[model samples]
Target chain A: MLDQAFETLKTYDWGTDRNLLNPIDEAIVASQADPAARRGLEGRLVAVLKTDVTRAAKDFVCRALMILGTADSVPALAALLAEPEQSHMARYALERITAPEAAQAMRDALPKLDGQMKIGVIGSLGARRDVASVPALAALLGDTDTAIARSAALALGAIGTPAAAKALMRTKPTSAEAASAVTDAALDCAEGLLAAGKSVEALAVYKRFAGEDQPKHVRLAATRGMLACAGK
Target chain B: MNPSTRKISRRRFLEGSAAGISAFSIVPRHVLGMGQTPPSEELGGALIGCGGQGPGTVGGMGSGIRMIAFCDVDRRRVENAAKRFGAKDVYTDFRKLLERPDIDVVAIATHPGWHPLTSIAAMEAGKDVLCEKPMSRFIAEGRAVVEAAKRYGRIFQIGTYGRFNASRDPKQILIHKIMASGLLKECQAVHIKRGGLKVAEWSGMVRYEVSDPGDREWDLYCGPAPLRPFHAHRFGGTHRGYWDYEGGGLADMAQHHFDPINWVYAKDATSPVQVEASAPPAHPEACGMWGWVELRYADGLTFVMDSDEWGDRYDRQTERDVRLEDLSPIDQQKIREMPDPEPLVGFAEAVKTRQQPGGHAEAAHRTATLMHLANIAIRTGRKITYDPKKEQILGDAEANRLVNQPMRAPWRVV
Candidate 1:
């Protein structure tokens, strides 16, 4: 039945009709059925996924790749994400995979992304919460994309590492939204660090934020973090 | 020629109906194919406001639309604005320029107070309008302009510019589909905390002139709005302090965020739901300079919007299983490994076939109205029943009166 659906979708000629996801949905399920067929299907999926036009195809491909969860799919996904032609859907699917191999691949790709895509990649890394990607994620605190830097801070919090907290403190947001995101991300990272028995590190971060000279609200949050650290 | 123009030129222009160049473009490819060779560089547009947001609109638009003319009530702003963009035409009065018929498009980037009047005037003069968002200063004015477009058959676009991938941005699409699908058990409560800029009269350096009593065009400036003292920054072009040109932040960001819940979940306009303002009007209160406003749709879905509030409680992961790191390289490579379709461009293509344009005007209107009423709720600090069908506020006579202000005569919108 899955094969039949895939055959139907592949033949449907989605040349102009982009709204319907039924065809791609079937393809993903079909691709997921067997590993032996995965390699061939992966190439086809990669083509549709890269065009940034095939929404359903991308969805199916992403889901199928996640099912495959092998080392082979990693490089292709990374390369597609790097290109302008990559669909947001494909990038989104890649972000969802949790295989350790997938994490390692992401860790390797961190140095190459600069400016927008770098921020995007960092954000994806943070969401995946791959602890191994911490050093690279930590380095992004000083990234030029304040949104990326802000996301990095939050990603660190979500990852819950002391290093993530330390890096979040160094980020400066240019806009109010960026500032708020950075502060919140830092606070979460700080709390995570404190929970991980890095009280001194958390305290320093809190002190910097809590200082009267710092951004008033960030400073206030830092003070609160310090008080929380003191067990008051 | 610019890319858009060039893109249009390549298409074949049949006699009546023309094929669109791309789903993303508003112009039909056939029309472009029939036209003479396009311009060499950026396609220029005119801006009427020449104020705070006016210049920014031109800047944000980038090469998409060039600034060819600058028109403002004040001579100084018109000159200054024109200079910034190297705009060749400067008009103290917008009427003269609007009559010229040379400008391709006109952006009505004026104060909320002047939006309805200026936009209607520009539209009547047969120009496509990229009017600023929220679409109207008063509720009735918005309705009037919507009618005007129908009568005139003009391509009027609102500037509510939000990044809505409602069909593909899984989180957004999922929520809309869920709400539309009725799968959420029940929408217990929706608390939307929006922290953004308050539309101050002259908060920025952009300035406007006081209405000269003798100037006939002063009547045009005051079109459809109740006559008030010549304050600099009342609605938008003011230089003094903030004034009630519109309903403050309530009219600004609150209108935006409030619309999502109301539009997503069908709600009634009529029937009063109690409303209470958190802070006193006209005074800077706490860190939350903006106040908390709550409106209960007739469907029992309570929409809460707080301006100057802190933090988003709704996690992206919670909504759609998408994490921040989900966008990473290795994992992302995993994505290229998968396949999905484009949403907006798809819809843009759909529009050519005479189908809906992503979210249609009705959808936009529903949301815009929701936002507008929330402003009324905040300003009056009284539970105001809204009648969506009649497009009027039911009880609270004062609030109802405030719903549509007295328009400046002769230059009326309708």
Candidate 2:
């Protein structure tokens, strides 16, 4: 099914390629059983994706992204993820891979992604429940891309680790979303940490998102998270 | 039209006559027949929307055409533009400016809200128009503008400017040319990245601030949008954030990125499948524009259009923040080898020959539709369906309503 779709994409004309995009996508999503054939087709699809050639090439590149995103095709997908040559499309495909292996691969390769790709990788970790990645995720709080730092906070919350919660509390918020997400993560992290008898860390974690210098909403939420965790 | 008495030099006239008198005689008398073209009949130009885009366009154009008139709601812009361009007349009202018989071309660089109405009005007034990118704020208005141009037989060009962007740099042009030549065996994907810096705050060169008291003219600026506060920044002010006026950066810049893609594609298509926007939410200082929007085309192709919120690395490296550079030299040389003609030059040439402009209303509408769809999909947090042929929304009824907007009371494009 994937081969037929790519063949159709190959023959598809530039201007009207939008018509063929849906079926090709359907075939990709529907082709579950044949992993090897799907891998071969996906490779062909990726090859067409990188060129600055026709709009079709660009369009095909994006479609290839969706295919690479599938969870089952781990090794081939990981190979693409690790290859810097296809970094642009690799970033797009990273978000699609939801499995633990894919998440671990992305996390292991996290330091390698540029600021932009780092954000995508962080989001993937948050989605994949990578609790063991708390330290790496915590370190990204200072990522050049504020969005990446914010995503790291969210990933910590998803991981639900005490150390992650403590880290979120210490981090300064930039954008409203980043601040809000950090506050939520810090609160959740405080509760988890306090329950584990990590009071000092919890208090510190609770202060950043809720402190007087922070916005009223974040401050209130953090305070509440701290109080509830301390049984006050 | 005697060859000797005509303005054409005797030698050239004799040579032309020797070749084919009857064939050359059939040509329009004013064009090349007697060669006595009137200087006074030179093409004249006027500009509507004298704000940021308007003035910049004039400056970029240098002194190509005769600037005869200027129009804007603000007297200050009119005065400055007129003084700068030596326009014979300036008016706060556009209707009066359109009345000039000498003006053959009109540049509709007005706010996005007024684009459809102004362009349609200009065409109705018997003038060709060059409207800014994302030509219409709403779909119905775009359709109306297209109808008006067709009915009046007027020339219409949508200003995406990406066609001219790649032409500015040789190396980038070369890269594009190589890709165009199909020499690159297989390109897995191409990403068009722009800086993540807030455009509203970028240069600090232009300040857009909304005034305190609500002015009566606010309704005019709000033409097709719902009634809202008289935010000066939303209209002609310095802090023209995309949230209040346009669909943020995606609407403001996607046409630039999409132009090259459209050139490569032979068809006019809209997003038939759902597009996803995995972006951070809005910030107070900045509008809720995306870090970037990941658009999945119907063919399963995904286009990642970044708003400055994503990151500024690409912007720093390329030195094209708001402004764009053309394809690299390698791309340009490669493009030269391809069969496709240069799109913008095609339009300019057509202007001289009275032929249809490239990237015509339909093409502009298609690209604009994608931009709007991307914004809508991101805003709605859902994948929306778009049908290019009917030029209407599909499946998502609520999203369909967003496809067109009702004009503010009394400011009708029809």
Candidate 3:
């Protein structure tokens, strides 16, 4: 049944009855308790990805990998990260895989891609909250493209490490978009720092924007953060 | 006249004149020329997602609201709604609409995916919000919305009034008092909401052809959610069917059912400590039918949501209401002596007075978290042990990932 399902999935496309792939679904459920079974299934799914399958078929495989894929599946998924049609789903799987190599794959792809693809990979790195990628993401904070720069700032903010916070604080925004993203990222960093029990560091982040020079709402958020850090 | 003395006299004269006009007018004030509300009294309102429940939500805000702007990813929806509501401004992007200084209140009737982002942006722009429910796509987004409301000091009300009605019910008030008094250490009550979840109706179509998104900013419509090929089912009310945008009918209807339950159980401030579900493996992109989900709070309160759309109904626990007998005699007497909880302020009043509404951000987030947790349990096909204070899934990295799912590029909730 599993072999037949793989054959059916090889030709799968939109508008096809998904129930035809029920065998794969059953395998996923059955493998939940067996780590060896999960790895075997992941290998089969990755094998299918290496084939010349339809985009929809690869999409299904990636979705399964999102649940079952480990480091062994990263290289196959990473190979698709630069392809426009497949990159989003590839990132979707890699973003959730709790493997350091997955984040590394995305970081490696960062400089090689541009436009939305690069932005997507940046987002994947941020979503993974990869501390190692902070320096790389911080480098793009000064990118000429407003969207890339804004995404970089927000990604650093998502990372919310003291290093990421320092990176955001060092760069001056070139556009209003970047400015807003910076303030928002700073607030996020402050909140994250406060949550991690580094109140003094959180207070410094908060105090950066608590001045009258900032917008009223930003000032308000900063003041609130400062008060929280003060244990008020 | 001196400035202070003249100011007092002018206020008295204006008050007397207003009173005299009201005393003599036989016709309705709106019918008379006096019906035109002053600028200070009228709220400038904007509506996002002008299809589905958008117009109805704005219309419910009463006549004191002036519909000034309308925004939707679909141009047709925005234009049609703007024309219907006499709004002069329409936009395909909400960021532009949020820039309008005149918009005092924003009614967000977008899909669950856009709820948190739009609500947070609106609050940060200094506008009060009446956001459509299932207040968030996941637990972390809901928490972000709550923090944004507090940080910006904005009035936020999820579009559910069950809690307000529950607050007025005498029986519910007693239950609330008993549960909230902190005197009852262990609550053995069980709540079961059976059927009416539209589980089958909203089960996602796993097979659909890609369709053109005509006159719709497809990318913007997919904001925060994954950028998938445009399918008609992935748009409009049916968007509830997809896991990318929502958690099927459970997310669509659970807030309506659970908001009041949360209030009565005094569970608004926290979440369930354990959640388990019985269902077939869920599709990664599409939502599927589920048999039941059982959520247990740390204090022994169990909430069983039986879909009744799939297999036999959940029979593990019988319905048990909280009663005086559940408490000790001394606790019962103390409950009797306790005053009834205060009446909850509604959205409109909250906006006007700058007070928290009955379904405020924290309460709404907790209610929405129930649906997210249940869906997570169903998707993972496992029992989930959770830390409510930390809002993390214990020993399950994959389940914890679902709690704070990643957003697509340029859309960070943090």
In order, the interface RMSDs are: 31.1, 35.1, 15.3
Q: How well does candidate 3 score on lDDT at residue B375?
A: 96
Candidate with top DockQ is 3
TM-score of chain B of each: 0.67, 0.71, 0.90
Docking class of 1: incorrect
How accurate locally, in lDDT, is each candidate? 0.51, 0.56, 0.83
Error of 1 at B1 (Å): 49
Candidate 3, residues A24-138, lDDT tens digits: the string is: 9889978888999988999999999999998988888987888777899999999998888788878878988888999999999999988877888887887667899999999
| Candidate 3 C-alpha lDDT tens digits along B190-291 | 999999999998885664678888878999999977676788878888898888898899998999999999999999878999999989888777899999
Which CAPRI level is candidate 2? Answer: incorrect
lDDT of 2: 0.56
What TM-scores does chain A show, candidate by candidate in order? 0.70, 0.63, 0.94
After superposing candidate 3, which stretches have Cα over 4 Å from the reference?
B1-37, B60-63
Clash statistics: count for each candidate? 44, 57, 0
Q: B308, model 2: CA deviation in Å?
A: 5.8
> In angstroms, how far off is A90's CA in candidate 3?
1.5
**TM-score of each prediction:** 0.46, 0.49, 0.90
Interface RMSD of 3: 15.3
For residue B171, model 2's alpha carbon misses the true position, in angstroms, by 11
In model 2, the runs with Cα more than 4 Å from the true position are: A1-232, B1-40, B59-64, B165-190, B194-216, B237-239, B242-244, B267-272, B280-286, B308-348
Candidate 2 per-residue lDDT over residues A70-119, each given as its tens digit: 45444444555444333334434444444566667777788876554565
